[model samples]
Target: MNALLQQLQDKQLIWLANQTEAPYEHCQSTGFPALDQLLGGGWPQHNVVELQSHGACAELQLISKALNHSGSELLQVWINPPAHLCAEYLLQQKRPLHQLIQLNTHRAADALWAAELCLKSGCCIDVLLWQNSLQLTQLKRLQLAAAQGQSQLYLFRPLQTGQQLLPWTLSLQLMPASTGLQIRILKRKGGWQQQDLLLPWAELYPQFIKPELQQRHSSYPPLSRVS
Candidate 1:
């Protein structure tokens, strides 16, 4: 039993509850200062980060900073995007169009297969995969693939299975807010369950913020004067 447990730990299949700090050696900034702080510096590299939402909730903008941070050197693969990705939006955000590649697979299995391949290729910086649901076993495979290639996978999923605890390096729920995304950190490498953090897009990305909330900040009284 002892030997088996050690093997599981060595394979990263078992994580002790008290273990804190990211298991990975490196992490990249998520772009938002508040988010970076919440994530303990940035998104952990060589791991799967699961992002869940009810529907389209400006999730792409959430990772826009990371994309820009990676630069145009390596490939950034998108597997099974719901709709045509906007080249203009990516360009405006400073993400290199030259490095971005979108792959459309005939089936979901094919998409996951492609994602694993991209992650293990060692030439891709990041892989963004959109799938309706994922089995825990499948996540483990992706996680291993990412670690092998020293890459990151930003996975998008529906909100239905958000409550279930999984083995992902990080899990978050992106709720749409008037100003931007109300992000809830479901899980992380450090095992810290953070509170819901509001990333005001109006302040960061003015173009994506709702019109009503654009002036909400200005209308507030000065901070020191509040009694």
Candidate 2:
């Protein structure tokens, strides 16, 4: 039994809770120092990461760095995005515009179908799916497809559904903040749930974090770049 357990550990199939092990080999960097540290190096490859947000809260900006790092050869597919992605913004972020693919599936069923097809195609580096509703069975199917194709999937959902923990490799909740974005780690493969982490964005993206008129009685100061 000891030898078998040792072999499984060597093969990366099993891990001890106390062992300092990375989630998976060759994890992708999120480009946020605090987030990267929280995710045990970076986002695990070939796994689904569920990102939940109430409304427009800089969620795309959170993963823009990882998408930019994805090579130009393999495609970065987006299915049922909240809105039409701006080409100029992609260019501004240094993303490979030529490798980007967007699919507008009006129906929920069609959106899932399109997402599954893209994830199982093996030609895509990563797939972004904006879906408000999903089931445990659907998530499991997508997870298997992702592993088969060796691609990553980012499923965007409404904040309400984030309360029920599912089988996603990782899950995060994004909330708008006065300074930047508040990130909560809802679920992680080898990590415990954590408190809200405020990531100040003025230093990283000045254009996104605008200066607003400060309210005298407000709890926090207006968000602005210190420099």
Q: What C-alpha lDDT do the candidate models reach, one value each? A: 0.83, 0.82
Candidate 2, 169-199: lDDT as tens digits: 7888888787778888887876766667888
Q: Write the per-residue lDDT of candidate 1 for residues 20-62, one digit (tens) a residue.
A: 6565578788777898888888888778998998767778777
lDDT of 2 at 150: 88
TM-score of 2: 0.80
The list of candidate 2 runs beyond 4 A from truth reads: 1-16, 208-227
Residue 84 of model 1 has an lDDT of 94
